[model samples]
Target: MSLYMLPLAIGPWQIALIVVIVLLLFGGKKIPELMRGLGSGIKEFKDASKEEDKDEKAKKE
Candidate 1:
């Protein structure tokens, strides 16, 4: 099984609780702002991963 699927990890209820807590902490007013930042971070991470893949391919050529 994948490490991500290991037992004792969060289930649906825990995930729901976490989301609720985050909403409460950041508030509905600011969740979108936080999400925007998160989206940018994810984009940057994906871009970096792709760049690394390209560099590895170039090195093997």
Candidate 2:
């Protein structure tokens, strides 16, 4: 059995089109608020992971 993988390429125009679709769906006013929430969620996840790593190190020592 042979498996073939195709390359996926995304160019500037494709990104611009995606941005346009998102803007249409979310509207300009809500994008900033949504982005802010997403940013905070990501930050919280990182902080939790760091705490877990510190606890693991303390246990090993």
Candidate 1, overall lDDT? 0.93
lDDT of 2 by residue, 1-61 (tens): 2234323466799899999999999999999999999999999999999999999999999
> Taking the tens digit of each residue's C-alpha lDDT, what string does model 1 give over 2-60?
88678757789999999999988889999999889999999999999999999999999
Clashes per candidate (backbone, < 3 Å): 0, 0
Candidate 2: RMSD to truth: 3.5
Per-candidate local distance difference test: 0.93, 0.92
TM-score of 2: 0.83
Best by lDDT: 1
Measured by TM-score, the strongest candidate is 2
RMSD values, in order shown: 3.2, 3.5
